[model samples]
Target: MSARAGSFSFDRKDLSRFLFDLYDYEPKLLRKLISARPYVCPFEDIERHIPEDAKVLDVGCGNGALLAILLASGRVKVAVGCDVHEGALASARMAAERTGNAGHVSFLKIRGFEELPADSFDVVTMVDVLHHVPEGDRVKAVEEAIKRVAAGGIFLFKDMVEAPFWRRLAHNVDDLIFSGEWVRQVKTAKVEAQVKAAGFELFESLEIPRIFYGNTLRVFRRL
Candidate 1:
């Protein structure tokens, strides 16, 4: 996590420790759980796909933990995180400043995709975002995210999978507790088709299974 050139890989423990001590949030347990998220989630796997020194954009970047880790990995030259939540944006800004990455990291407040600048990035990501979007707006949200991906750049979409009754229930419960809303599960095949229709080709699909959390990551390349 030293931000050395060409050293994008990081130890989980190191990352957890760095994030754990990075902020002082109320309700001490929240800090511990958030810091330990990488241990269960596929943050490392997601990091592996990002090319070195690529300009990155992250949509629905709650708390900006992923973007912070990406910047710390030294693989990203610049990172922009956009979200509708002002509180989360504040936390994100703090993360960047505390880590001395203020120049390379920026946060934006966007209520809708149209608010985003007309600029493309080498990598555009929407992780655990679409599901949180209202059912009617999910497709449009994805289309907008795809439009921001530069030609030949990668778009990584990560979200919870709808499957075996128990896993879906667990994710729903988690969302209800933290988000105060029920997540709408979108079908994987439909998303693939949507991306394909938008001039993107499927590059890879990865299924990540964590305890009580079944997730899938779709990697697409804009043609």
Candidate 2:
């Protein structure tokens, strides 16, 4: 059978539970999923506005590296990371503790977008998580993510876009690595336009280079 044909479908909750056991079973794979390199370029354009010790949410928060970076920078007052993968949350907590930042973070295993409150956060961010959302729910996912932000608050979106060179190359490499989780090649271009249609005014869309394809750092205002 083809790898894609056999891949399992994980909603927010299932993905979270799977994450708790991720490293013990697949340490290297988990590491790649949580790395910072893929994000360095795009995130550079947007600034984290949560006050020094402010409330922040990391959606599809992988292992919470972005939150950790914000915490370490002394910019965030409190940060909550939510993911469908418990392993990702566990890894984030472990990482926070290792950095002497224990208790400053928490993770929620959401069944879906409904698990979160509306207008409860000062800022919401998603890095490399957009592509993982189930195809049908992506629009609702982004719309809900925007609602989680307080009025006048910002949404920081960073993800990959298809360019001739990087799309094929990165997708191939990712397919080789995780196989199942790599974004299905079909939806690349449509995602950003959808984000705009979902009501997010594009703040910026910067291309990061062959480090990856058209790297996008979209800042959306929740006004």
Candidate 3:
């Protein structure tokens, strides 16, 4: 993403500055990350997949960007956003209120994937938060997110990827130079395998380039 007017490009130092300057800005970091990305490409195809008033679950729903979008469209009657970061959840709640969607979205502070019930939601989505999760736990997180989804619903994910060599090198350099943010990890293929292992099938894979980095929009449906 192009550097915001006053906001420095997000790097490790900038992320550190952000965490401190907005210690309670867990969700804000999330919002900025998504803002940097192109418009929700996943929404184009999956929008038609969601049923009216479906029990949509936004897992790793940092600051409710997607949740707000879905709710605003009047497609989702009930939406729940859960994050392991309490600070992020708090900010997510505030965003909902600010967006006039507090009535439709519920933000929950969870400690891990274990905290959420199995098969509890109609649709579950993990946005840009997957790579942030520690590597060892990523699989289980996907598992839990899928378990929360009802059969016939979708599990949507649109985030960074491990692309071609130069493209990936660019991603690393950008992370190092502009944002000092290492992306922590990149799991494009692993996530594909994990999603399938969790009883869902991948239906779409699209390449989308954004301001600062690029992404892969992967959409899956529960079997």
Per-residue C-alpha lDDT of model 3 across residues 96-137, encoded as one tens digit per residue: 665445787788888888887554677777776776676788
**All candidates in order of TM-score, best leading:** 1, 3, 2
Candidate 2 stretches greater than 4 Å from native: 1-43, 46-52, 185-200, 210-213
User: In model 3, where do residues sit more than 4 Å from their true spots?
Assistant: 1-49, 166-181
lDDT, model 2: 0.60
Q: Provide the clash count, candidate 2.
A: 13
Candidate order by decreasing lDDT: 1, 3, 2
> What value does the lDDT take at residue 9 in candidate 1?
51
* Candidate 3: clashing pairs of residues: 1-211, 1-212, 10-179, 11-179, 11-180, 11-181, 12-179, 12-180, 12-181, 119-147
Error in Å for residue 134 of model 3: 1.5
Task: Return model 1's CA RMSD, one decimal.
Answer: 1.9
The better-scoring model by TM-score among 1 and 2 is 1
For candidate 2, lDDT tens digit of each residue in 110-170? 8787686544777788766766666778877877787787766777776665557556467
Cα RMSD, each candidate: 1.9, 10.5, 7.9
